[model samples]
Target: PAEVPAGPYDALLEAAASALDANDFDGAVQAYKNVLSDDPGNPEAKLGLAQAELLGRVQGMDPQAVRKEAADNPGEVNAQLAAADLDLVGGHVEDAFGRLVEAVRRTAGDDRDAARLRLLELFEVIGPEDPRVTAARTSLARVLF
Candidate 1:
């Protein structure tokens, strides 16, 4: 029996996971991107990259402030998106999905489209196999078309 050595991408994947664990979102993103450059279909690298990118956008944001802004300005798409991001990071998966679904229900035209796009991005972050994502997809479809 012959033993196979680990591929070079293995180190990059490890670095990406380590960076994610350290909350070094930028580092994780770069590492994941490096992995994808070599193996574009790698699910773990894609998921890691998506999560890092989402976390990077919301990094250093105050959850309470974002939530208050969303509450105070229900019509503001950016505020709602920010609040949803915070909720996702905080483990409030249902809250995150609900916020975006509500936004989709209330908005129209480009605003509605924007909310829909953000919801899809959240789906990517949460992964398609997650039950929460499955439920959210059904809710989104009901609100959408």
Candidate 2:
């Protein structure tokens, strides 16, 4: 177990870590829950929980979960981007749309450009013939470059 928290915390963290590595989402979710129950202020616990709920990848891994790690402290854009990837891979077209929509709404620069590029990639994944792709493209055109 975790000697730091000195109890269920270590075990909880361990369980969540193992589950996350194996992509056993439900197990990670439950383990993270236990970590939070013992130490809501623990950064690892918070990050682990968010990671468990996060649906997609970012920066070669999971951004939704990473975003949870910093909690607006930093790298939130990466997290958003990760979420967009997740949505695309998971076949959650609307979700991918939403993630990019929010990203495009940012300060209107690199982040927006990155999001637009990612949205375009998703369109390719789903195929340009998809209606959602049309709508996503139209939305991107309206809100982004």
Candidate 3:
């Protein structure tokens, strides 16, 4: 992918990052969307939007409850998904990736697709260049194939 040049959107992206730092996920999401509207293929904007959306989704969640649910219901795909989100937010990147990859290994049809998509979204949030993401990609492909 070609790099998005340093342009007016730089300030907007900075503001979006500030919003994320401040836990203002809605503001960050909107800011990212605004940038995407103008530069549809901007990688930074895409990453910011994914992070904002994930933060928003997990913001109200109780970590303990989510973890318990996931642990108790290993076959429950949604529970796994929620727990994976919380794991990523809590900086357990490996745990998040492993959980979803396991989910993909054990599930089929829409459930497998959901877990796979969530894992991909997390890849965007973490940046595709991260070694962990690369490892997870390999793991995911192993399960998928």
| lDDT agreement with native, every candidate | 0.92, 0.68, 0.96
Instruction: Report the lDDT of model 2 for residue 14.
Output: 85
For 17-87, candidate 1 gives per-residue lDDT tens digits of 99989999999999999999989989889888989988898988988888899999999999999999899
Query: TM-score: which is higher, 2 or 3?
Result: 3
Off by over 4 Å in 2: 1-75
What TM-score, over all chains together, does every model reach? 0.86, 0.50, 0.88
Looking at model 2, residue 138 earns an lDDT score of 82
Steric clashes per prediction: 0, 3, 0
Model 3: residue 46 alpha-carbon error in angstroms:
1.7
Which stretches of candidate 1 lie above 4 Å from their native place?
1-8
What would the TM-score be for candidate 2 when compared with the true structure? Answer: 0.50
From the highest TM-score down, the ranking of the candidates is 3, 1, 2
Please provide, for model 2 over 1-145, each residue's C-alpha lDDT reduced to its tens digit, 9 standing for 90 to 100: 8556466577678878988899887788788777778787776776666555553233256546654643463335666766666666566778878777767776367867777776765665566678888887787777755
User: How would you order the candidates by lDDT, starting with the best?
Assistant: 3, 1, 2
- Expressed as tens digits, the lDDT of each residue in 45-95 for candidate 3 is 999899999999899899999999999999999999999999998899999
